[model samples]
Target: MSRSIDYGNLMHRAMRGLIQEVLADVADNGLPGNHHFFITFDTTHEDARLADWLRDRYPREMTVVLQHWFDNLVVGDDGFGISLNFGDSPERLFIPYDSILTFVDPSVEFGLRFETQDQESEAEDAEASPPLRARRDEPETEAEADAAGDEDEAQDAEVVQLDKFRK
Candidate 1:
């Protein structure tokens, strides 16, 4: 058998490390400048923790905005913990780094998306699965733009795909 370096997995680990470093900085110094995050993760992941209601509502995936009013940001080697408001109710969530799907910083037009082989196969089987590409389209409505923090309008956002580097 030919053994080769798993560059895709390596890149994924590096990207996740980058997110961890950035989150650690924000936990200590708060979000700098106009930077904020839209983090989407797999709600069904084994280590992912959230309110039962939230899981019911979000089912497979959930996207959380880390802007305005959030508290108790804690970064750890395996994952992070944060408290966010949902309909005036503050709920704490523990999101394992491995569960994350996409991390976006619309302020700087930057984004990262991670896909595992299992997820790719599942996506192919599921018709409603979201597109693999990170969308950089303009927001169609004011409400959407505000609620999503203009993520859809990030025209220059660079979405990194490790597959391109694979042999």
Candidate 2:
């Protein structure tokens, strides 16, 4: 039996490690300059933990922004925990690295996306395109900024896909 290397999974691990490092730095020194994250994760993942209402609202997936007001960001080897305000109510969440589907920093026009086995199979049959870039227009109000951080930008941002590195 021939054993083939799982390059895709290897790349995923590397990318997740990168996220861990970045979050670790942010946890120690806070987000630098305009760098902030728009992280989308699978709420249904067994290791994911969010408020009951949050899970109810975002049954399958949820996106959270790490910007001005988040608190208690603790990055662990396997996951991270954070407290964010939802309608003025602070909610804590624990998100496993494997559950993350997308991580984007619109300020830098950088992003990484991980596809699930199901999504990967579906992607194999469809034409590919770069991930949507989040808009960076300055928000007019604090309320707008908070809400806007979750919105996707119109312009195309450069996303590094692991598949491109495979032979």
Candidate 3:
């Protein structure tokens, strides 16, 4: 049998949760002693933004290093905003949670592949989630589902954010 899901809005929120969790961790604990991030995002993706010159320069994907010199690591509900040095010139960027294509941290053997806003998030969600757990597809009680949903959201966030982006 075939079934369909409405992952359109869900994916974006899921993506947001992922970014929020990791960023919260970093903010709370201070990068975990050399655990930095190399996040590559779609420069032109709608919710994403970059210095005008930088955008003109790299229209597609740009990899940023989260190191000591970096500044302004702010995470919003929808995405993140930060500034990176692109050859001595500090460039500010706005990356929508949905526009992130890949997140990697070789330190922990971790990486995350963010589905494209249009067609990917749902695809990955269905592929990654185990069939057994979600098979029932029943309406869960508010209290039960609320607790479960929060946990599920966290796990889902971890799976998607801390996944292998290239491999």
Worst 10 residues of 2 by lDDT: 127-136
TM-score of each: 0.74, 0.76, 0.61
Candidate 2 on 1-167: residue-level lDDT in tens?
Answer: 89999878888898899899999999999999999888989999999999899999999998899998999999999999999999899999999999998887877867777888887766667744322222335443348658887563345558999998999
| Predicted structure 1: lDDT | 0.83
For residue 114, model 1's alpha carbon misses the true position, in angstroms, by 0.8
lDDT (CA) per prediction: 0.83, 0.83, 0.64
RMSD of candidates 1 onward, in order: 7.4, 7.6, 14.9
Winning model by TM-score: 2
Separately for all candidates shown, the number of backbone clashes (residues 3 or more apart, or on different chains) is: 0, 2, 1
**CA deviation > 4 Å runs, candidate 2:** 127-167
> Candidates 1 and 3: which is better by TM-score?
1
* TM-score pick, better of 2 and 3: 2
